[model samples]
Target: MSTQQPENTAPADRKVILVTGASSGIGAAIAARLVTEGHLVVAGARRTDRLRELATSTTEEAARSGGALEPVRLDVTDRADVAAFVQGARDRHGRVDVLINNAGVMPLSRLDSLLVDEWDRMIDVNVRGLLHGIAAALPVFTAQGSGHLVTVASIGAHEVVPTAAVYCGTKYAAWAITEGLRQEVDPSIRVTTISPGVVDSELAHTITEAGAAEAMRSYRAHAMGPDAIAAAVSYALAQPADIDVNEIVVRPARQR
Candidate 1:
């Protein structure tokens, strides 16, 4: 077991990673996984209680690995909040090694359903939220000369399904935004998009449409656990600094 270091200093192998939407599901799994790998994980979300629970649950692992989990209240839709989130981490740790833009909402409904609010919610969280993260972290990475940006996009980014038109559009934007960042940034800054297929998560609980909700229930019957996607994130981060893994799509074998 390793003893914890001072707040301002991190070991050479330890990374300062910030994760958004970390209250539950994929975000929580990613934060826990990174912390166990000896990285300092700043987990942010709207649900402070769940965030605290996550920190409590990982206390022993973090202590043993010389990692630490810091839970902060965050609303990704607010640009200022996100900027402050990144700035706070840099202020505390001296540098932020990675930013995982994982906050997203999915309220599947047909175009004719006229669920404009749901559509807007998806755009705000999925599209604008990703942009907000990039906006906040790009400068930090540029100033530091190195950083990794990981987007937890959905497989919907690649293909559309019934009632997922708006959701898929937002995801496609996430994929495109991340791809554009990868092309524009210097090689010192790494970018990756993780597209997951039907992972067990709370995203579907947002679907108010009865039909879409019912359909998702059947579709998710063969879903993979959140840890599966966490493993993908770890794999991307584990690569050498010189190797930039552009994108990875992880789906359950049973998914068609």
Candidate 2:
């Protein structure tokens, strides 16, 4: 005779998570996936209409699975908006569990193109925007004595490519800064760095330089899908609370 045993499963505590740049692409994908996982997600982006659509769709899907979403209009470039959104999330959820800094721009251009304006925009959004998220969420994490910060850097941060030097530089800074944040935060605070290689998204569409745009066409041809990243992020969060997944790089197996 054998006695039946119950399967052990982790308790599902509703985790409050904020995901930025969520109007489309990877950010939106992460937000959508998390919502489906029973997490209370605060999805944000500059495009209010797109954000609204994503929110509604997410809510409807979540409702089917017995969950919901909280949407907020945010331009991560605006420090005030970042701060306010963090505060608002805490107001609603009672505490912050995770912050996914996913807003970024890949307006790749060769140095010869001298698209310094595009360079600046990439830096402002990819680097500074991530910093603002850290600044906004760190305090909340510190107060709670526990939290998680996930930054979506790029594989370009690992290998510099044609017409991607400056964009890579910004990502390099982003990777460095996020690592620094993780080192300084409390042991209870988990930090995950998700560096994905070319992903099927609108990321390349932002490239303004003609040559750079053409160059990226070949790269996107080999890029991975955004769900690969969404899965990575979800895995990082699903780990035991004490574990801090310092970094996870999901690049195409075909990528060099």
Best by TM-score: 1
Global Cα lDDT for candidate 2: 0.87
In model 2, the runs with Cα more than 4 Å from the true position are 1-11
Candidate 2 residue-wise lDDT, 39-73, digit = tens: 88888988888878887887656765444567789
lDDT of 1 by residue, 209-240 (tens): 99999999999999999999999999999999
> In order, how many clashes per candidate?
0, 0
TM value for model 1 = 0.96
How many clashing residue pairs, candidate 2? 0
What does the lDDT read for residue 214 in candidate 1?
Answer: 98
Compute the lDDT of residue 98 as modeled in candidate 2.
93
Candidate 1 deviant stretches above 4 angstroms: 1-11
Per-model TM-score versus the true fold? 0.96, 0.93
Q: When superposed on Cα atoms, how far off is each prediction in RMSD?
A: 2.8, 5.2
Q: What is the C-alpha lDDT of each candidate?
A: 0.95, 0.87
